[model samples]
Target: MAQQRDTAEADRTLKAKHRAIWASGDYPSVAAEIIPGLGALLVEACGVKAGDRVLDVAAGTGNAAIPAALAGADVVACDLTPELLEAGRLMADRSGVDLRWREADAEALPFADADFDTVLSCVGVMFAPHHQAAADELVRVCRPGGTIGLLSWTPEGFLGQLLTALKPYAPPPPPGARPAPLWGDPDHVRALLGDRVTDVSAERRTVLVDRFETPEGFRDYFKERYGPVLAVYRAHAEDPERLAALDRDLAELARRHDRAAGSGPTVMEWEYLLLTAHRTDTSP
Candidate 1:
């Protein structure tokens, strides 16, 4: 009991900072460019169909939710940051897709138990401070036999490498916080989901990131709009040396992955894991 209380308290403290960091940037601009196809893929992979009640947890700018809605599902887009939720609302309106939007935390979802036919998160819930709590909430909200789909950056992927490169300059997570990349590991995911779900499957998928003239330009573009990258810059506002070192590291990583350095804009493939599982029947 004491450990649970401590963990909950720690999560509360960290969540405030996380909400602020995510809200600090205009993530919609970046999300708009990368999320559509990924969202569509998740929608199809999860078997979301017309009349299904779909919940896109930690949905940034309504990526998955919008597509699900367009497919005739009743979609609700939820996120911790109100700014992102608002961006989702605007984007939904522009897309002529009607969906509900809610500002809610992934670790403690505001919905009732067994409330959704399909629950999805795309590179979103992995950022939750408490992985187990978030995972439990995702399972709890999904109806029996419903589908849960997720996308996460693998530990050996480009995004994972970027996170490792930025670790030195960024603030450490709470003492017991699980590493987010664990979600990308199929075995780890199976352990996390445990017996509560069945038919667990995972696959690797690649999404192409926008091409930039140079690695430095690519780094700069992300720093301006990617929430986590913006947070790192903000954390090092008074330390130019650390910030410069971080920027150099990011640029180097970009250069290392850039295949067409001298030919044309640098297009790179970001590999992520697509996970799908069905909630087990709890009725007895």
Candidate 2:
């Protein structure tokens, strides 16, 4: 009972945060920084073809789902937050692509055996409290001879430094935070797949980071477009003192990260791994 209650509370809190952050238009641009590279790579790795059924896990705002659908694959996009799904639906419509948007949990997928020809997730599985369970769920829905493709961020270089700079204002994240969505250590993915797959491999790619156009852009984007950070501000209900402090802290951080507007685009180096594995039945 206690565990269920805690989970419920956390879900509510995270949902509220996610909704608020995505409500603003600033987030999509911020997300565009990293989404395209990951999305493209996953699509290529999945080898989606016309008429093939594809499952996009944690499909935030249809970044990957939109492109895959454009390629003529039948696509199902699933995510935990309704707000994010709404955004994705809007994007899909704008792109003139038909994508089935479903609200579902990654750890417990609502699909049947061999339901999809390919399973793809862009920074999705890592959110599962039980990585193995979620991974198993991913493998479960894929056809016996299908492909499983996952995209995860590797925390290193400019990416690590940038995230470190922004960490103070965000929610008190769990300790030792690696990258999110696909947050687990690399070994965990290999262990989970076991003998279920073959031709398994992982690689890195650079994502173009474009959230802040200027120092002021950074301040506004973080304050208005970041969910967990705004959650912290929401927590200060009726407390003017804390609000001022948070504002001051964010201001300082913005100044530190801010560079001249025409100083050329600042790119955050994100090492993302595209893991590809084929079901055992399909392999020679």
| Candidate that scores best on TM-score | 1
**Residue-by-residue lDDT tens digits, candidate 1, 227-281:** 8888899889999998889889999999888778647787778889999999998
Lowest lDDT 10-mer window, candidate 2?
175-184
lDDT of 1 at 215: 86
Reference-based TM-score of each model:
0.94, 0.75
Query: lDDT of candidate 1 vs native?
Result: 0.87
lDDT over C-alpha atoms for residue 164 of model 1: 80
Per-model lDDT: 0.87, 0.68
How well is each residue in 1-284 modelled by candidate 2, as lDDT tens digits? Answer: 99989877876665454445545445555465535556766887789888889999877776778889989999999987777788778878988999899987776789887799989887655544456667788888898879889887555533334445456645566433334534423565778788888788776665555555554555556666655455566677578997777776665654554443348543333456678888776321
